[model samples]
Target: MPPASLPSPSRPWPIPKLHLRIDDLHHEGVDIFLNVVNPKEALHEAIMASFQWLYTPETVPRTVLQILLVLRPMDGVAYTTGTQSHKEIHFSLDHIKRSVKRARDEIMGVLVHEVVHCYQYNALDTCPGGLVEGIADFVRLHQGYTPPHWKPTGGGKWDTGYERTAYFLDWIESRYGDGTIKELNEWMKDNQYHRRIFKELTGRPVRKLWKMYCSSLGDPITDGFVLVSKLIVKSYKPLYPPTWKGPDPGFL
Candidate 1:
């Protein structure tokens, strides 16, 4: 007889009801996704990553009750949307197909990014969009899901977003000590976002922090331009080409 299924391990944070919706069963990406991961396990791990990286047991948000994963043909890699109690992660099968060489890692990375949105605070809808995205990618980076293409360099504004802003936040956490990002996120939960928060957290203004970060990377800005050896336009490459507009409106 086959072995019995093992019991699920206990989780400190709430595990929302997980669901999956495949828009096209016949899509080639569907086969690839299935071959690579167990949906339940993958989603669970993504949630745990957000909790571990972004929140402590006492501070983890308990608002999310359900998370639905929708796989379909889409323009970009993925975007998330839903009410406070529920979230839907719409992942692109087309993107998955293109990432066949690294489907599992890419899928997990995207999932972790989207899942962070479900739990992250938004400064009462007043936080800069770039900072919001940076936090998501920050958690993804901590979870060890960084794509091979991602590199840590500093040049542009501190809130440039994605891996750029993520690396900046990572630097803050390293320099200021752990839980710095957690405190930053917590402050956003009940107050409006102000540049002063950085000062409050690390005894320095955000601009000063950005300058130090750039200097550490040996890519300080000069005359309002990032003085680097070469500028690498960061993108998901073939999946999110240069022509791609930007994040979906519903992505927040």
Candidate 2:
């Protein structure tokens, strides 16, 4: 389920020419694909998911004039890349076949993630690769397409990529305010990336925020940074600490 507070596509973004190229019509994955969704609608949905979550029409890039989805038999998953005016998405039929039980969700999820890459600012290609992937998954997560097997857990750095970074971003968005990620993305529009962007947005540096995030779940941090204990998930109940006992006052 998507968090209730996700932003919407209140205005129209530039609608690119959406096209699909199915490399194998006889593939088993094609059978499931045709059974589940209309290709045009699926592609359009992914586009809308990208615009709605990451931008308002005013901030959206109008340079993307077309998106071509190429579905072929390949290993692993999908990827997207192209010039400023045209984008190409290469989706794997093999991956779709493997995720057969949840084909519709998985395909749309991958499409959403890829489409995000086509439109998202890359800090002129200097942005951390993990943040790039995380922004993609963040759009996927907000689209209500997160797989059932996905879990929210901390493991490497804040920019660990994929769902790890997506969850961390969602937590930050929930903690500081809505559209926190939106502002972060906008800052990357015309300039190269710097770690200071996080501090500018949240009044704390990225490292400090990540440490506070780690410490929230009873993890100890060796790096003594200025900590803010006020930002809790509020969903995890404690056995003691009477002051912490309550239904989420923030959510209420």
Candidate 3:
């Protein structure tokens, strides 16, 4: 199975065979879930968000032949795992019940994170688990599915998983330019995970970049301004064009 294609609104992702298996039909989570999301569209939307944020049509992987989402009575939250050609997402119904007030947000957030694991590169499966989880949440962060509880700046290690790393990556892309993370991901496609990829992509290594990121907490635009300006200058081109501050719908 080849990887899925990169995303495009003109061509919706070819959603693979989607199957939902609910372990405890009587669980209160089931009631709440049925009250909210439709399994078909929910999974489709999750897949699209992953494709949209991480992969472009030319680069999206087409190998995932199927995605089976299992909503069962289990511990913790949710996780995705399977062979390269198939993926399974095991979500805890109890956790779903606990998130009843924000069921839609919580469900979609977890789904997006899990779906990313299905398609994202893992440096031949040697990438740090925290970084892997962080990448998943990074995609989730970009999907506009952030939980209301998520706060951007908290003094934590840059790779401190989940939203912390997601926000760090968000800042990295904002500083380096859009698709910088995608380039980082692509770099890992055939190579081992290396901190040097940061330098390769942005001309600054990860440590220095992280330090600059943290110091910029008080004034991000000022800190990011320099790198953004440099990218605009060095990366300029016609037809292809140079990077811009934030999304340039103008290009479209």
Candidate 4:
């Protein structure tokens, strides 16, 4: 069964023209995919998650005219590429086969992530790739599609990407209040990315915030950084969205 339905915006956000292409029509992965989900519904739902979380009708990007989904045999889970007006998502049949039992959730999760790339700004490509990937996973996490293996623990930097940074962003949004993440994205819309944006969003240095986040998790970082005891997190809610234990994301 699909885990849970992703929430849609109260009012509809405009959906771009969506198209689908299956390069390996004969692949068993394609059968699993086609049997489990409708492409149109899947894409629409993916766009819904992205638009609901990342934009409003008034601020949504209109430059995108089409989103084409291409399912083919490839090395990775998925990736998105396109011109200003057109976007293409290449998904791996091999990955789909590997995720057969959770094909619906896995496919939809990847779709939502790639769709975010179609719409989110990258500070003229100056944003860290980890942050970008985290934002995409943030949306997926919110969609109730978090894979079984995902969790919020430590060892790497905050922007280690994917679930690690996604959980961190969720904590930031919760502690600071709504719109902080949205504003961060807007700040990057026209200007080049700078660490100062984190300051502007949370009134603290990014490095400091990362330390506190590590502390909140009771992460054992004995390097030069201050070790915030795990007790501090006891009085507070989890850093991620409440829906999932690790919790949820940001943007307008």
TM-scores for every predicted model: 0.85, 0.84, 0.81, 0.86
Q: What is the C-alpha lDDT of each candidate?
A: 0.83, 0.79, 0.74, 0.78
Index of the highest-TM-score prediction = 4
Model 4, CA-based lDDT:
0.78
Off by over 4 Å in 2: 1-11, 221-252
Of candidates 4 and 1, the better by TM-score: 4
Flag the better candidate by TM-score, 1 or 3: 1
RMSD of 3: 10.4
Candidates 1 and 3, the one with greater lDDT: 1
- lDDT tens per residue, model 1, 1-252: 999996553646789999999999999999999999999999999999988888877788999999999999988889899999999999999999999999999999999999999999988998887888889998888888888878777665677578877888888888888999999999999998888999999999887777777767666465245344423322221111111244432212
Model 4 residue 116 CA deviation (Å) reads 0.6
* Candidate 2 TM-score, C-alpha based: 0.84
Clashes of each: 0, 0, 12, 6
The 10-residue segment with the lowest total lDDT in model 1: 235-244
